[model samples]
Target: MSTGSGAPSAPAPNSHHDTVSDDATATASARGTTPGIAAGPAAPPRKGTFSSLRIRNYRLFATGQMVSNTGTWMQRIAQDWLVLSLTGSSAAVGITTALQFLPMLLFGLYGGVIADRFPKRKLLLLTQSAMGLTGLTLAGLTLSGQVEVWHVYLVALLLGLATVVDNPARQAFVSEMVGQDDLRNAVSLNSANFQSARLIGPAVAGVLITAFGSGWAFLFNGLSFIAPLTGLLMMRTAELHKVDRVPRSKGQLREGLRYVSQRPDLIWPIVLVGFIGTFGFNFPIWLTAFVYHVFHQGAGTYALFNGLMAAGSLIGALLAARRAGSRLRLLVGAAMLFGALEITAALAPSFWLFAALLAPIGMVGLTINVTANSSVQMATDPLMRGRVMSLFMMVFMGGTPLGAPVVGWVTDAFGARIGFLAGGVISLTAAGLIGLVLARVGGLRLKIDLRRGHQHLTFVPRAPGAAAPSGEKALAPAA
Candidate 1:
């Protein structure tokens, strides 16, 4: 479904900060994703894995997001299934998906510009309310037996419009909540929360879809916005880590683009994800085909598949939350594994075998998401974060508009296996190429050891005196 913004412009809340610890700076220098802010004294480590939650504002935000993200997942399942049922064509499902993300493709950067200038909390309130209204409208039409394919299309477009702002704002807002010190942890935990909801949302959506109809799921999703709206209202603005707003300007968008282009640490990861997102991450298309066509399963099994994937994603996100830094090598490695797993899953001989592979796919997928997200946010200047993240997300989700329909057609004509396999090959190739380029930029080369009980693989400096800026400047030092 889609949502729109009828709310008139209001002044936005301020932005956030960028800082790194000495240790994190050294590690970043070695990895090529440093924030480029000079190293400060080493900061004490966070007391626990959930250190970000120690901040009251972040805790409130997290609790609220957990509810809404689940709702969002529910809508995704119901919307896709509903479209497939109505049209009886996976390509139609693809079209629905494309429409939903097309706005991100077309207008995502503008959303980022708005996000930088506005108060995120207020922006979220507006966006969330609009999204909830769209859900309610869709629910009402479906429940009243007046809904049509056209109605779904309209709602999806509207929703995408709202998301163009909501997504960039919400992502940049995280750093504002906990500051750079706990930014990575917060980002990881946010993924865990989304996946946690993924597990529950699909199951619930499955049950609701089967028993009543998709309408109830939509209705529940509409109401789910209440939690976040309440949370946004309750947050103490004074407690937020506020930064100066970017004054309105004509060339701001170009500035964000230029910023990313100059930084290899930021650009390569974004480029890697763009390729991966455009091809490999067509799960909605792939999974729907597997369930409806290949496995001949009902809604319950589809939900089960999603839940299993969610389980793995949750594990990966939690693991990421515990670490103090994000490495380009780690991100590259995860992307490779994700692609390999997808190829394997596509060729699985049995339904159960196919299902079993999904969990790991989900795991590595979350790893890529968390790693790339934190790394980019860390390396960006605070003033440009909204625009940078918009670019990151646009390259990621926006690519769906280009990929989903093509993947859907491939599924329809060549069979789901061909479509899935093609995506995997592209993903793996992209990851490998990006990894090599990043390694070269870092002035490092892969080292291999043939002996038993020795380290089998590592990256070493190409020359003793070589400076790997990508490693040294990729991320902020741990703070």
Candidate 2:
């Protein structure tokens, strides 16, 4: 989302790093769509990705979130390692992951309702505090040496319950902070901050896990929550432009479902996200299992791989920030490229070759992510933003809980090679299928409107009287 104070802002704590990674879906919704979407000259001035930071409130929020996100990543590495250590099964790690995200999948629609009904700032305070406490509790149990697998499972489930409400609130809150004008930039910059933290946090976690234990990482993450909470409290609510929360009516959920079903602009991006998410976005499961079991490496290697990917992701996000307008053609093209890159990475024979592939993988993934997000957000009406965004998130993040465990099983049963191959196949298939669906819906016969502004999203069929067949192409005004 917008990681600034009032004019911008925005977790579920699934892992200690849960605070960072899980929130990306919400952040994508916040930025990819809402604000700063416009037609402009190519190559604008070098406004830093963090240009939203020029706003005092947003700067404070971004700084706090950046610090907290680093700690969150540290916790995620530690948590995954701890689970692996305790159960010694990739399946267990996957289950823990599923539990953490299950709430989002099951209750995402309900969560949107909660966000629409509540003031987001106050809601965030509660969720952030609950998440922090969960991390602290896990740390205490682990440090006291009373930790067990069940404890991790329980806490993960609890953190997930909080996420069911928290995720949507945070996504909706970003619109309030930056207004719509700077929302897109703020959102892209926010993703950059997250990936930057990913680049740093995991490498640091690798060192900490190798040197000490998981306990300190959890403790550090628990304490990191204070920074964001303080930032939230310090914000001047009087200056914030809170959105008008409409009272829920009968069949509100169904109405939301119907709203998205009718519009290809909104529905296609979310469906694409689901496909990629289910097949492509199992990095944590794949990477963890590969480094530990396949490559015969340890935590250090795992952290390095993620950090490198984050480096690529940072570059991708920055490039995306420079994109003046959102387009589905660009999104589909990037997704296809991303899937191909992942396939290449999967087939790489050497560890160095595989690691090198992660950079472009990150780049392509971020490109598709930012583009799809901005396209969906900018296209939907403001009244339905929260619900629409939540569904968008459900497709994006919800696929993880459903697919990760299956991917984990495949990796355990077949091999890490097969897992990566399967992921690549799924991603490519999703992109292609979604592209076909969009083309049919938009009545296209191969012509793409990539450079056209967002308003040109509507593509109606040329009428019988509009044109003749042979030599010249028929054109009509966008509805």
Candidate 3:
């Protein structure tokens, strides 16, 4: 649901009173109403990733995003391909990629602060409209056959600036749509939706580029933004959940850094994601180069590689959706597996074999991504979620600006093979280090403790960061 500039009021206790089930348990629970539930006699039936669909507003949001995201992917491929066509320098392509993400590195923290201070739906509306205009500008330049590499760069910067606001608004807005109860499921399904679009977007872009021109792809992307804008406008404002907006302290950005530093569990995952984003996940650079240079193929092959990876990613996202709760085990295990698969794919003998390898690579990578995202989002406080997520996204995406050029240079200097191998090694090494760090900090000594279910967990936080516990006294008890 959408809300205006002001914070939405708390939902009324009698909001769902009319829809009671005709059962004794239901009657008991409905005796006195509450905002989330009637005073329940039993816990609600467990729902999975699709739980968000029960809310009509979120369903509309998802549907519109799926359509728009596909076209966005098309523009991304077209932009990269156009740069490569003009310059033939992987370095130039890397620079363009860097420009697109550079804002996340520089402005991401402040973007988070803005998300906290503003109304997300309104913020999204403005950003989305701006992006649409940027896309239109690209289309006009390209379709008229007057586009230049410099124009592309300038347009990319504009779009990137818009994304700085769009990213945080969208991330924080999800929580407001679906309350905390089904948030993990909503997050998983959202991942699945994105991967599903990934599976379609690039392939379609490839065909469109071959048939008409890159300009048409740009035009399609420009038009696509309308879906999201419409969705935002049409949402029911009253149902939105409001978060208390806190004024920023002078060193709030520094405070965010300190908060991350204090949590080994959170810090390590962010570190691991940063490593992967930097080295392991430069698919734009790798796939395009792999097709043109190594395989001596054209745009079709490039699109095929991305599509196969997305196909794998789709399954991975679904599997994550099937799982009920997030687990640190999933994060570490998936990272190791993703790295191993990436290494194997780099060694594949033929183009088809390498393309086939993308599925597993995509699967493991997506699993790690969704699991890490859900864990971090669930762990953070509502008040600080925007800043924390922004930090997470900055580390995850910003590393690309620093690493893309290096990876591009490596691919050019040594070979694509060496570049892939190096990334895989770094990723695996990161996973191992994170596991060890968790063990050391969480006091995990490989001993069993059945009472608290510490088997899967390596480190447990001593207290709630959001709330202070009551006073306690230490005591000795018989074993």
- Which predicted model would earn the best lDDT? 1
For each candidate, what TM-score against the reference? 0.90, 0.84, 0.84
Report the lDDT tens digits of candidate 3 across residue range 1-479. Answer: 11111112222211312233446334543554321122322422456546678987788789888988898888988888888888876767777888788899899888888887788899999999999999899999999999999999888878878888788788878888887776776777788888898889899999998888899889999999999899999999888887777585687777667766655446777888988888888888877778878898877777788889999988988787667555565687888888888788878888778988999999999888887787667656677777778888888888888988888888778777777788888888888777665544432333436765457433332332211111100000000
What lDDT score is found at residue 25 in candidate 3? 35
Worst window of 10 by summed lDDT in candidate 2: 470-479
Task: Give candidate 1 regions above 4 Å deviation.
Answer: 1-47, 469-479
Error of 2 at 85 (Å): 1.7
Distance from true position, residue 354, model 1, in Å?
Answer: 0.6
Q: Model 2 off-target regions past 4 Å?
A: 2-48, 447-479
Q: How does candidate 2 score on lDDT?
A: 0.73
Top-down lDDT ranking: 1, 3, 2
Rank list by TM-score: 1, 2, 3
Q: Between candidates 1 and 3, which one is better according to TM-score?
A: 1
lDDT of 1 by residue, 1-479 (tens): 00001211111212122223567657756756433432322433544567778888888888988898899888989998888888878888888888999999999999999999998889999999999999999999999989889899999999999999999999988877877667777888899899999999999999999999999999999999998899889988898998778999899998889877767667888999999998998887889899999999888888899999999999998888876567678889999999999999989999989999999999999999988887777667778889989999999999999999999999999988988999999999999998888777665678899899988987666655344453333322211
Which candidate model has the greater lDDT, 2 or 3? 3
